[model samples]
Target: MADFLGTDANPSLDGILYPSVQGSEGKLNVVLFHKAARVQALDIPKGAEISADLYVETEDGLEIDYSVWEEVPPESPSATSNRDPLDAREPEDYNGRVPTLRLNISSLRVHRVNHIMFHTESHTVRRHRFEKRGAEF
Candidate 1:
């Protein structure tokens, strides 16, 4: 069976990126629902937001550097102004590339079990599933 998450360093995420890892450093116990996927919400820094990246492992039994996540654009938007709970007006349109989390699995074993590590700009590793965002999936 295909591991819903990757094996060892070669993780295979469902493509649904969560805001942050669960029960980690500064993350809170909040739920983030985007599209149709529901994920545990991450309490990131004041200006930080959701982002995605592929985590890969090499044949040398070493995990790939997490810096590659920088290439992909975060699917979620950063906190913006207009925080009126009663307001219904739409905020500025967010048009950007879908964040792509790439992994380098050049020498990874076929059946090795791996886990993907989500992180913030401060480099906090998240431990949770990247479920569908919003609620549409």
Candidate 2:
């Protein structure tokens, strides 16, 4: 996914673009969706750790190093049930749940970001899934 500051075509995003967004004040925020297909293709097991590096390109052809924010998991059903009515929270879906692995670009100043790139890596550990009943085989 890519976000641009102005309404124009970004050559860097050609051929390998997901979606684009227009912003103001030369500030752009990008989000990479973690869809079900990607999850299955990568074979991302449950409780896996993933990380990524973020890079941005300015309108003036200047490459900048933007800060990468970690993924924030959505609130669980039990956690939401304990929330106070006055507390502010994001709207829930039909199943009262929110997905994860949505990236956000957090920059203090306007960099006129025109394109974004993410280099991601995942570290998964496999564990035995078996229960010993009354006696071992």
Candidate 3:
């Protein structure tokens, strides 16, 4: 997936940074990414904690209101997986994978939204193969 802010044609005026989750029924879906070699794996441990603050930004690129955000953390096993199901590969069938942390926010009030900002923090263990790169190798 492209960087939420980087891909915007006119980031200043056009406020929607990421495509809103359709059929979400008033829920916000967030995917977290980490920079690593293609073959590397991510390992988040059980009971790991992830938190984020959501903000609604104004047209002038200033934060306006604090959006009420609640996170439904991914299942422990799903969170610890080496590969994210949403990750796309080069060959379409390649084993190449990227680790992603998914969070679902419920009960957010959005109005005249220009852009959304997320401040996130995670407490988890991330592991990768030393020699070859990923857990699979």
* lDDT agreement with native, every candidate: 0.43, 0.44, 0.48
lDDT of 1: 0.43
Report lDDT (Cα) of residue 80, candidate 1. 53
lDDT of 1 by residue, 1-137 (tens): 22333332244343333344644766544321222233333334454444543455778766645432223335456545447766664656332334333334454344445775656577678799776768666
TM-score of each: 0.19, 0.19, 0.15
Q: Which stretches of candidate 1 lie over 4 Å from their true place?
A: 1-36, 49-82, 89-137
TM-score comparison, 2 vs 3, better candidate: 2
Candidate 2 residue spans exceeding 4 A from truth: 1-51, 78-137
Which is the winner by lDDT between candidate 1 and candidate 3? 3
Model 3 error, position 107 (Å): 23
Residue 127's lDDT within candidate 1 is 91
Model 3 scores a TM of 0.15
All models, RMSD in angstroms: 23.4, 25.1, 25.7
Worst 10 residues of 2 by lDDT: 33-42
